[model samples]
Target: MREDIEFRTEDGVTLRGWHYAPDGATGPTPLVVMAHGFSAVKEHLLDDFAGFFCDGGLGVLVYDNRNLGASDGTPRGEIDPWQQVRDYRTAITWAQTQPWADPERIGIWGSSYSGAHVLVVAALDRRVKAVVSQVPLVSGLANARRLIRSDLFAATRQLFDADRAARYAGAAPQMMQVAWEKDPAEPAALPTQDTHDFFFGPIQDRAPNWRNEVTLRSVEMFVEYEPGAYIADIAPTPLLMVVACQDHLTVADLSLEYFEKARQPKELVALPCGHFEAYVGEAFAESAPRQLAWFRKYL
Candidate 1:
């Protein structure tokens, strides 16, 4: 039901992933193009999500974002939101041309960081027929402000400045853990308890390729991103946003605020759990089915 595939982006970087088809299917099928979030690989609960669609008689294109798991890119563990957004469009273009895929029926599913990317893509690329952004990072700057301590804000800015100067002088890019297991107060990229537990937990046994590190510059770029601003532009394309009610990383109030900014043809479903919980256990059951229904209705 799944096949390994690779395609080049416009800039010639190869992104790799799986193309899933329902068993005994024939003719062109609606395809949902998907990618993982910040510093995440497809093994991070994406296979489970893809199965929900593929099992419901839809095709799915699940890929590792560039520089993470199963995909190829340089300066590993770096994440540039705009670059990933471009790649999402690139993946959609490739999926559209596939013999088994219906070009006009392309839908997109993204979670966490890539979740925000899909919002930007759907607004800019009219070819996206439908979109599902789950537990998305809406406002990077606000999120950073919420997560970082005010007293440490100056020191944090210093980190970004020092990293910039070091790179300017030919030093290797500075790196930081994607999550910190022992202390939430640490200087890791995510710096939240749920993020640490989610990334550092047993899921690692399933996805060993996932490194705990990210480029320090990735944090700077993250704070500058404001994908929520694109929400208002996503109308005319059916959109579904899944928000975790108790989410600390991407707070619920902020997500709700942006959801209102969006015009019609959009729906918001609240999962009564924290951000990371939406990926597994009961929350996954709550989140995945509704998303599949959206794809079924609009894809």
Candidate 2:
């Protein structure tokens, strides 16, 4: 079952989405707090993913990140990684107070960009009992370099410089397309064929609230983020890293390296697919059950 839900962050921004209750739950149930990757909204396969957990007797709190979807924040379509991390802590706090969620049995789930976020959140907040980071980004600077060409890197920095000047001069933040054509000569945030197909195809068809734009500063912050550094600290708390073997967006090897660094009580399952595939079709079928088992075991 799904109920419309919203909760306030410590900074006072209200995040809105749905709280799912397991069909046969008799009391407060283990709850998984979930959110999407990058600029994706809650409508983008989150419900489908949440369904897996709810059907398996787990409740879920799924919401959009700030400045996107139904959530409230200024400078719409902006993504500040640190701010998003803070919001995850706030979401966990909100979940603790809800009657449908077992305060002591809370797990956190995230995919793609949010997957990277869960790593950071779990390290910082002991409140998170279990964490499933699916096809997560480990090193932003390294991933960005992989996505962008060496020759174009300098130009990208210049663009960021220009946007910073514009913003400081009282102009709105410059925007960039999150993805471009299947074969794009023009630069886009996710300039890959798979990303284009997934975002503009299945993702766009499902989520109109999903935007194709984000502030230029978001990319800068993303590059500056290094969530993998916290992997060792996440030990003692059970950690699960679901890596897509073919994932180049976040890089499978990077995830594996970090997973190796994480302390005991951790597991890594590598799906034989790309980054986006881990969320749907056969890859999702394989990944979701594995994640549910992790949560059930730990949370």
Candidate 3:
């Protein structure tokens, strides 16, 4: 059965998570610590992945990052990358104490921006047994370049908002728009075509609180933050890199470069779709099972 668990972060914010324990399992099973991508709630994107693992005789702990969803924190729309990484660490540490989790066999899974956080967390926490980073955004600079090429004005405005939020620590300026807005000029602007369906369609059914707007301040730090730099140190431990050959949200070529630098015990699987399409379209069925197999082998 699955239960909702609430826990406190080091910064005094309350975080809500879903814990799925396999039926009739007597002891700790392998656990997957799953964190959501930018501007997304944990339950919407992660629950399916968690459910699959739980059904396979594993425990899955999926948590909402501090400022979004049901988590307690100020500045509702803020997206501080470093703070998110710290919160992920705290969540992983907390997962170790859950009775159904095997601390030594815990693995990390993330996609897009939070996918980068999985790498950051794994490097700092040696206890992370394995990691799966799917179509990760290894560099903030690359993301910035993509946004600029797609929409200069909207990208600039996003940067301004994020900086203002960081300086004030109050509620960040709100950006509201429909999910399927076309072009970057629209308020809830998206860079690619699949993003509209991926970000809005699924959440429309499951989570009412989902929004496409993220704190603009995230732009300031996201470009400079490179999670791929530490990939070599995580070697000998299992690391799975899922690359989308035609990704538009993140740089696919840069991801390939990082994969080249990474050491042994690493495997890269290339898919034919763009970034978000793989998560919702037919590829998800193909991708999720492949990832589960890799985690089962390593964890």
How high is each candidate's TM-score?
0.98, 0.97, 0.89
Better of 2 and 3 by TM-score: 2
Model 3, 153-238: lDDT tens digits are 56666667666766688654644432346564554434555667676564667876665566545555565688888777777778
Residue pairs with backbone atoms closer than 3 Å in model 2 (clashes)? none
- Mark the regions of model 2 whose C-alpha exceeds 4 Å error after superposition: 181-183
Q: Is candidate 1 or candidate 2 better by lDDT?
A: 1
The number of the candidate with the highest lDDT is: 1
**Each candidate's lDDT (Cα)?**
0.91, 0.89, 0.78
Better model by lDDT, 2 or 3?
2
- Please provide, for model 2 over 176-248, each residue's C-alpha lDDT reduced to its tens digit, 9 standing for 90 to 100: 8888864587668878888888887856777877888899899999988999999899878899899999998
- lDDT leaderboard ranking: 1, 2, 3
Residue-level lDDT tens digits of model 1 in 20-132: 99888888899999999999999988999998899998899999988889888878998999999999999989888889999999999999898899999999999999999
**Residue pairs in collision within model 3:** 140-222, 140-223, 141-223, 162-216, 162-217
Determine the C-alpha RMSD for candidate 1 after optimal superposition of all C-alphas.
1.0
User: Higher-lDDT candidate among 1 and 3?
Assistant: 1
